[model samples]
Target: MTNSKKFALVTGSSNGIGRAIAENCAARGFNVLLVALPEPKLEEVTNALAAKYPNQEFHCLGVNLMDAGAPQEVFQWCQKNNFVVDILANNAGLGNSGDFLSKKAEFYFGQMQLNMVAMVMLTHHFLPEMQKLDKAYILNVASMASYYDIPFKGIYAASKKFVSSFSHSLRYELKDSNVFVSILCPAAVLTNPEVIKRDANMGFVSKITRQTAEQVAEYALSRMFNRKPVSIPGVFPKFYRTLGRVIPHRMQLRMLANAFIKQSRE
Candidate 1:
């Protein structure tokens, strides 16, 4: 039997921004389906949310989204369980920073698979069901890096660019439908110890623009629910995105290259 309750299915919900988003969804009275890698952390998060939101349903599946057919597997699992996912949060992604050629080809491929392919495929799988709902939402977590081509993070940035482009185009196509698509482009989210330490080394812009996972989650969900096309959590990131528009492409690329190169050395 199909579950009558609507769910918000969140990818990467074991930790960081994804976890924060999941908590928010539960708070807003939506049942949550948390998806992350198979690990104790995933179990912990699922248990924690279940305890915290006793009235709402909280289920989890541990799966590595980068694997082939993983998106389909997730869809199948939801189907078998009769979970009706009205809100799909594509928040799982891999972000690595280094010279383009420094990483092995396999690493880049896997990054692309997780960051771009998995997101697209998952959306493809869930979009039809979303369209059937009275109202639905797709929140894609991209990065402010999507607006620029950074030197050390070329592949990661490019993949996010793909996300940004794809999301906007999808939103256009779904404009007349019940499904609403929005993208969150946050800058320097301090989600963990490593991210906090990295933000310290990221200079003034990153520091000023940085946000906590909770902050990003709150802002993103608020804006997404309001049907905003793009949600930028911080003021500086919003300003920087606008600034990039007037700057010549060559100059912007050069500036970004220099900044990332310096950060890479630090």
Candidate 2:
């Protein structure tokens, strides 16, 4: 039964890394359910994937995951459609780039809900079904900021840190189960023109560490299927993660602040 039902549910599948992951899953012959807001991009991606992978089924659900009830709605939709999800990719996230004080509390809190709460809710609802499968996987998309206490991007960093920690603990807890859980931490992915412009402004380190969405997705899924607990997408980001651990805390803070200053100048 499990082998017969190879459906993957990917949140935020309209664009960026989410789109890449969805495309990858379809290429691997998995029926994909693309979830995102009710936007034109959602249908666009669904149609494109359907056209590209004619044999593999592709469906789209346009809903705002930020709504507290969204997780249940997604689960019910799967039930109604007879989709047995074997893979759950929680890729939807939000972040603010500037100083925390620049935005209202609602803005920051909304990001928290989307980045952390919605992810947790989706995982909570989907993990049980995944556990029933003979083989399954859960891939969460975190960020490089997950490793640090960033200044201007404080809330965003904290949210990603929660994701990183939650994924690690969940993986360990489900170690005995058939389902494999992995978290991807990638830095400066070239997802769109705006992101490219932003990364360009972040200086040499950002440029060198940046990866394409396809690149990140390919490497992340490979490592996920291999049952790796964590995946850091680029050589530089991995090295940077390791180096951050060894560096003194205060020094790290100062360095990050300085980097932020340099980025501001750019």
> Scored by CA lDDT, what does every candidate get?
0.90, 0.87
lDDT of 1: 0.90
Tens digits of lDDT, candidate 2, 53-135? 89888899999988889989998898777788889999998866666577798887778888999899988988887888789
Q: List the residue pairs that clash in candidate 2.
A: none
Output the worst ten-in-a-row residue range by lDDT, candidate 2: 257-266
Quote the positional error of residue 191 for candidate 2 in Å: 1.6
> For each candidate, what TM-score against the reference?
0.96, 0.95
**Residue range 1-266, candidate 1, lDDT tens digits:** 34366899999999999999998998888899999999999989989989998999999999999898899999999998889899999999888766777779999998899999999999999998888889999999999999988888899899999999999999999999999999999999877665666677777978899898889999999999999999999889889999999999999988888767754665
